[model samples]
Target: MFGRDWTEKDQSVIEHHDYSYIVYKSFLKYLYTGVISLPMQELLELLDLAIVYCETKLERCCIQEIKRGISIQNIDFLRSIADKHKKEDLKIFCLCLESRNS
Candidate 1:
């Protein structure tokens, strides 16, 4: 993790930004406990955080979300994330979709 001092950020901005309270707590829990309960509604963002934290094991729990019941926009996001993370299975999934579309 890049050590920029996140604590000095203005409270109002932190509160209103895309980082929700629940996600914030989860991140803190991950920092302290190395474990977290994934709330269903926040799975996608949580997966992104997991990737950022190098928590690949935690990220796998939501891989199915990246693989199914998705809109094109989200599929694109997932593909980008997979590419960033070098997640081979996600790359294969996107490749299968590309082959289907062609």
Candidate 2:
């Protein structure tokens, strides 16, 4: 991480070297407004970015949104993401949902 030696102008020019433009912009908006309204299609990618940045609150929000959007067709994909991210709670939730629908 960059140290505290940066000027305001330097800060302005400092890119979010960790995330994509869309993900970073959405995250910045969430920081400002505490809300994000991106399409479900974008949630997983944002979740990955949130995990990488150690943004626990943002990860929780993403997981909630993913739960709301889940369906039989996407359960496997969601489970895979949960496993990949070590989100055991989400993995359990997805498994329960899958069992209920089976």
Candidate 3:
């Protein structure tokens, strides 16, 4: 992590590493509004970034959104994301859904 102390002067040029522009913008908006409104693909990306950044609240929000948006088409992919992110609840939910559908 960059340890450089940020000041008002740096506000104009401060750059975050790793995240794409859209992801960073979305994250900034979430920080401001405590809400995120990305589609599934961007939500997945944001979730990964939240996990990496240790933003547990944001991660939980993303998981909730993922759950709300889950469908038969995206269930397996969502399950994989849940598993990879150690979201046991979401993974279990997905598993149950998959079994019921099958």
The digit string of per-residue lDDT tens for model 3 on 40-73 reads: 9999999999998899999999989998999999
User: How far out, in Å, is residue 8 in model 2?
Assistant: 13
TM-score of each: 0.52, 0.82, 0.82
Please give the distance, in angstroms, between residue 90's alpha carbon in candidate 1 and its true position after superposition.
Answer: 0.8
RMSD of 1: 5.9
Where model 1 places Cα greater than 4 Å from the true spot, the runs are 1-19, 24-42
Arranged by TM-score, best first = 3, 2, 1
lDDT of 1 at 71: 53
In model 3, where do residues sit more than 4 Å from their true spots? 1-17
Candidate numbers, best lDDT first, in rank order: 3, 2, 1
Measured with C-alpha atoms, the lDDT of residue 85 in candidate 3 is: 85
What lDDT is obtained when candidate 1 is compared to the true structure? 0.68
lDDT of 1 at 30: 64
